[model samples]
Structures are given as C-alpha cells and as structure tokens.
Target: MSTLELECPGCDQVLELDAGFAGGVCRCSNCGTLMTVPVEAGQTAEVVKQRQRPARPDRPMTPGEAEAAAKADEQVYTTTSGREVRVGKTSIPTAQQKKRLMVRTATAVGFISVLAGVLALAGMGVWMLSQAQREAGERTVIEAFEYSPGANPYDQRLANVLGLPLAERVVVVVDASASSEVWLDEVNAAIGAGLTETSSASEVVLVYTNGDGLHMHPSQPRAVARWRADQLIAFQQGVSTAGEGWLDEAVARGMQWLPRQMVLVVGREPSEGELVALERAFEADAAAKLDVVAVDFDSAALDDLTGTYGGRYVPMTREQLVRWRER
Candidate 1:
C-alpha cells in the first residue's frame, strides 16, 4: 500500500492520506472545511501565505452528505496484519498533554497556598514570643520587690498601669500627724504598692506631712525611696506633733512639684484652709487628679476635693485595706 500528501486549497494545512482516498471528500481538521482531495497527487496547487485566514462556511457539507459521513466515520485505521491505531486531529487534546497541563496548574496553586500559610505561622509565632518576653520582664520586677510569693494581685494591678503605652506620674502624700499613727501600716503598704507600679521612666513621689512637710525622696527610683520610706514611717512609736498648719504647708510644697497627673492623699480630712491649699495646688496642675484615702477621719472637704478632682474618697479600715483591689 502507498500514501499521498497534499495541502488544502483553503487553509494550506498539510494532510496525508492513503492512495485510495484520492478524489474523496474529507474535513480539514484545522478549519473543519469540507474539501475534495486531488484526483492525482500533484493535481492541486498550494495557495499563497495569508496572515488572517477566513472562517469555514456555516454548512461544511450538505445535510445528507454530513449524515452519510457520520454514519461511516471509524476514526481508526487497520493494517494488513490486523493491527489497529487511532488517528490524530488538530483540535483534540491528547491524554498526555491534558495530564501535563493539569499537573502544572495544581503544582503552582499548591505552592502559593503553602508559602502563604508558612508566612502567617511565622508572623504569629513572633508576636507570641514578644508578648512572653514582656511578661517575663514585668515578673522579674515583681519578684525583686519581695512581696509574697506567686502572683500578688496588688502588684499585678500596678504592673498593668505601669505597662500603659502613655507616660504617667503619681504622687503619694501621707498625713504624718500624731493621730495618723494607728493606720501607718496600711499607709506604708499603699505606698509600697505605688512603688511597685512605677516604671523606670515614670515618677513616684512620697511626701510625708509631719511637721512642715517632708518629701522623703525627690525624683528618685520608686524602689529605693520606698524602702527608705518604710524605715521612716516605722521610726517613731506614735504620730508626731504636726498640726493642721503643717499639713497645709506640706500640700502647698507638694503643689510646687510640677507636672503631676495623679495624687494619693492618706490622712485626716483637710480643714477649710487646708482644703483651700489643696485646691490651689490642684488649680496649679490642671491635669492633676486627686484620690483621698481617709485614715481615721472624714469630712465634707474630702468629698468636695475628690469630686472636684474626679477621684473617689476611700475610707481606709484594716479590713478595707486588706480587701483593697485595683480599680
């Protein structure tokens, strides 16, 4: 048997066929055009090259011819030895080509998804590590203060505030009069709590209103001053002979310290004059807010001061001191 090759007149796509197919009608696999094969192998001439080829006619063949061709279509060829082989068409995809395309697309999408997941996991891990480091630093400070072992609620509360992103300052003023002696322990503890909360850059002032008034430590690290304050508060067996005039003077001096945001006063309620002194101090520092913890006495002046400063007046009893929780 022999074969013949020719180019279609319409599309010029090369085609091969058996000698028996001469003068037979077939479809062009590239353009689906129905054409008559050349009667002689050399009879048909190739057309000139074209950039844009025209589309095939809507009806490639008569209805009857199309039906007859479909009925006879086998899509396979057989050899004399009875071997069969499938034929190729331009528009149809082979099995191997389809598989390769699917594998490449799947591999690309899968690589992108895995890379995104790994990046997200790394970012989360870094954030968690940073948080743990910060907590560890706070815990070390809490332990150095020598408060009761484990988590002290008071220290933890203070630590939260100290960890605030904004800068903060607190001044503690305690009444050191003879009558305030009974509540000294509670006052000392409150002072210690304040010290625990003061960060390295933040400020804590311990002012004792004994005679004229005493600034125990001026602009010093809270931990160092707090220890010294404990010794001072415990030095005298009873309250000193400080009068209301001395208390007023102490408040006036505290006022001289500028840029105070929060003030804690623990002592007897102020007299009218003493109240005026405190009011003036508050006026001087417009941003200052006052919190008063009454030791043994309470008065309308304390209420008014707390109201004006947007703070609360806490009555400090032994039980109340023990039960105190940070708000």
Candidate 2:
C-alpha cells in the first residue's frame, strides 16, 4: 500500500493518507480543520471517508486570559483547537483572592498601630526628661541662699548682709528692755547668726539692758563661744521691763570692752540723753566701730551714728523676719 501527503487548505497543516483513500475527506489533527485529500495522477477517485478525531477540549483559558474574560462578562472566544469557549460572568475577586486581600489589609493595619504606639512612648520619655531638668534648675536657685551647715535662710541672709568674718574683738549689745518684747526672739536669732562668723581666737561679749541695769555675759572679754540652749533660755528669762532701760549704760559697758566692732540691736529710738552718752562713749574710743540693727525702728540719728563710726546700719521689719522663719 502507498501513502500520499497532503496539506489542509483551511490551516496549512500537512497530513499523510493511504493511496486507496485518495480524494478522501479528513480533518487536520493539529488545527482540527477538515479538507478533502487530493488525488495522484494514477490514483482512483474512491471518495473514501475517514472519521475526524474529536477536537481536544478547547485549550483551558490561561490565568490572565480568564481574568480578562470574567471582567468582560459572558465573553466568547475560538481556541487554537477551533472550538468556541464561553466564559461565564464572574467577579474579579473569587473567594480565595478575597481572603488573601483581607489578610494583607489586616497586616498593614496592625503594623501601623504598633508604629503609632512606639512613637507615643518615645514622646512621653522626652517630656519626662525635660521636666526633670526644669525641676533641678529650680532647686539650684533655692539652694543659693543657704551657705553653711545647719544654717537657716534667715541666718544665711543675715550673714550676707553683715559682711561676715567678724573682727577679732566684737561686742553684740541687744536691747532687752520692754520695747524689745515684741521682737526679742528675732533679735536673739539675729545675734546667733552674727556670731557664726566669729573666729575661735576672737573675743566676744554679749550685753543686754534690763530694768535693773546692764548685764554682760562672761563679765569680761573672752574667746567666742557657742552658747547652749539652756544658757540662752536663762538669759531670755532674766530680761526685766520694770524700770526704764539703762540703754546708755549698756552701750558704755560694751564700749568699755574695747571691741574692734560693736553691734547694737535697738528696738526703739534712743533718747537725747542716751544719744549724747553713746556719742561720748564712741568718742572715748574712736577706734571702736559700730553697726546698728534697728528692728522695726527707722532712725536717721542711728544711721548717722553708724556712718560716723564707719559701720553699716541694717533695718529689718517684723514681716521680713516672719517670712525668713517660715522659709
């Protein structure tokens, strides 16, 4: 048996056929096109027939093509196998695609939330550091007024005003007369502050004017001493307001101590006779200078007195003392 080769006219696909089946009709396997086989010069026109193989199921649509077809809605197309395939109307996101998209969206939201929390904490940390720095600065300013151990704000302030480091021979005369009853405690505290600046080798005397006369601690000049609380309490109790105070006598007694510096705590203005006596006492020993602390008392005469003796005059009010004590 001989065979003949022929090309399908519909799709240009070559096919081989038996000579006995010359002029037979056949379908192309490659493209599924049907055509009649041509006859050779010596072959008979047998009009033979051959059954066509069923066209392969239309080539399944590719992923990309299927998506396009679904979007196009009920689109139809001829496949390479010469069969028409109809795509049903289908949404872009199938159940599986929708699930994947939801997971991606949730992950993005969670990441954004975590990032926001981190930023908030960082901001809070910065704010706390700034607050700490601000408080430290405030503490520094408040500490500036304290200069010595166990020293209150009042003591430090008084020390600063008095120009501390007292002279070698110093005398502090406090007025314990009736006029000083209102501010006696403050006067005592002030004297204590003044004594803090005295050196161990320095001589100090404390004098006070009472109804009887003038009273002096130690009765003579001696090295500076820290008075005990009981001693101070006793001294405070001994003050008498029965008679007019001997302020002039007290001043003279302090001057007799021949101190290099004398501090007079006065609660009231001096009388004319007292002033004259003080002037006379100061003139007797011109070398002894005077500094006056006038408690709630403003006296130009005292100011002039301090000026003549080359000393400072400090005036303090009850309100200022109260405020200092509170601090």
TM-score of 2: 0.48
The residue ranges of model 1 lying beyond 4 angstroms of the native Cα positions read 1-167, 197-201, 219-245, 322-327
Tens-place lDDT digits, model 1, residues 1-327: 455666666677676555444444556666666666566762332222222323435777777765545434423434233334333233221111112467778999999999999999999999999989766754554343422323333544443121211123455566776666666666556455544444433445656667644645554324322344355345433445364426666666666666344444556656667778778888877876776667556667787788998655655464555554333
| Local distance difference test scores for all models | 0.53, 0.62
Index of the highest-lDDT prediction: 2
Tell me how far candidate 2 lies from the true structure as C-alpha RMSD in angstroms: 24.3
* TM-score of every model versus the real structure: 0.43, 0.48
Q: Model 2, 1-327: lDDT tens per residue? A: 344567666666456544444433455665666565455611633432222333333788778765554445433333233343343333111111112457788999999999999999999999999898756643433233433323443544322223233455778777777777778776565455554443244567778886777877756766544534456456656765545678788888887778888878788898999999989988999888888878898999999999999877878776666665665
Model 2 misplaced stretches (Cα beyond 4 Å)? 1-165, 193-199
